[model samples]
Target: MAFEQSLRRPVAATIRMIVPAGGAKPAPPVGPALGQYRLNLMTFCKDFNARTQHIKPETPMSVLLTAYKDNTFDFIVKSPSVTWYLKKAAGIQAGSGKPGHETVATLSVKHIYEIAKIKQTDPNCQTMPLESICKSIISTARTMGIKVLKELD
Candidate 1:
């Protein structure tokens, strides 16, 4: 009701700031460790070259669901917020849009999260990633008023 609407508003605003959802960068940081990779640097490097560097370039950046052929989300949100939400769901910071280069491209939530970020962290990171981190973020996004674009089941 009114309470839910009030909550979603702020989340959407915060999302808009996290990532702008513009076109791919000329040299987007590829792989997990363009800056830092928790797992393997070589794997990231291999993944980077294969995923990025093939774009037509010079295209406007925006979250456009219609542009892709395999899009199947119930709600299509073309914004930086959606990107932010997905990264948050996966328990990592955003990477480059190009898969091998910086990121693995836009993917659905069910496809990304095996566990929360904290659980994936080193034992010394001081916090165990809780299973609910993803759910909590979803709840927050709901309050902020962005169409979740997924079924909670």
Candidate 2:
């Protein structure tokens, strides 16, 4: 029991935040949240920015950070949200206020497939079938007043 306990580090806190890709700085949300836990702000900002450099700048990336009692931390960065992707693919600035009652834009099955493929790369979604992901995306599109067509006209 003693050996096992030694191997496990007590968790200080679990922090969740949405930060722009490659835009993490030791300021505002990031600084305040991590600073409260006495975690290294500059280290986190540098590592996060490096990891998300491949993604488009200013795209919101969801972060799950685990701060340990020893003032150390680990974080996982997730891709942009489904709504962001949907809006970009539809070339719209925002979803329709009325959703089902009003259609703001249309997307093709191919677009759904592509988005599903991207979402599959997420650690949580890796085990979900591609078809399942596509269906979920379609459902979200419906709620956002986006139409999914068999093919583009």
Candidate 3:
């Protein structure tokens, strides 16, 4: 037991990035980001691509990587951002430039609730209450110039 415990190394650093689904490559961002840590870039690219294969190609995915002292690393892939989901549900390409002054799209409260449910599945949000998650989603929608309505009229 002691020998096994000794083999475990503490996390040396954490890196976060938004990578396109199934689009990991040993170039530019991925290369530079992990290169400094002396991580095996090709291995990361291959593993990331394989793990994200089920998602649609080109969909943006958020990933968190933990590098240990011995150069070994682990990572977790999170679902897309709330902003992305909002745009999809509202059928908009982008948020309004003047969020408060102009509205780009309107979303129903039901939509907000649904998004909250999706977000709640994320590890970071698992401990948060559903009502709080819904509120946060509403706030994000507001900032994106998406008016949240009680019902579609």
For candidate 2, the per-residue lDDT at 3 reads 97
What is every candidate's alpha-carbon RMSD to the true fold? 19.9, 1.0, 2.1
Of 2 and 3, the candidate ranking higher by lDDT = 2
**Which digits, one per residue and each the tens of the lDDT, describe model 2 over residues 81-106?**
89999999999999999988999999
TM-score of 1: 0.22
* Local distance difference test scores for all models: 0.34, 0.95, 0.92
lDDT of 2: 0.95
Candidate 1: lDDT of 86? Answer: 51
**lDDT digits (tens) for residues 69-128 of candidate 1:** 222111122222334545555455544434434433333445324323522342322263
Order of the predicted models by TM-score, top scorer first: 2, 3, 1
Clashes of each: 21, 0, 0
TM-score, every prediction = 0.22, 0.96, 0.89
* Off by more than 4 A, model 1: 1-83, 87-126, 149-153
lDDT of 3 by residue, 36-95 (tens): 888999999999999999999998999999988788899999889999999999999999
lDDT of 3: 0.92
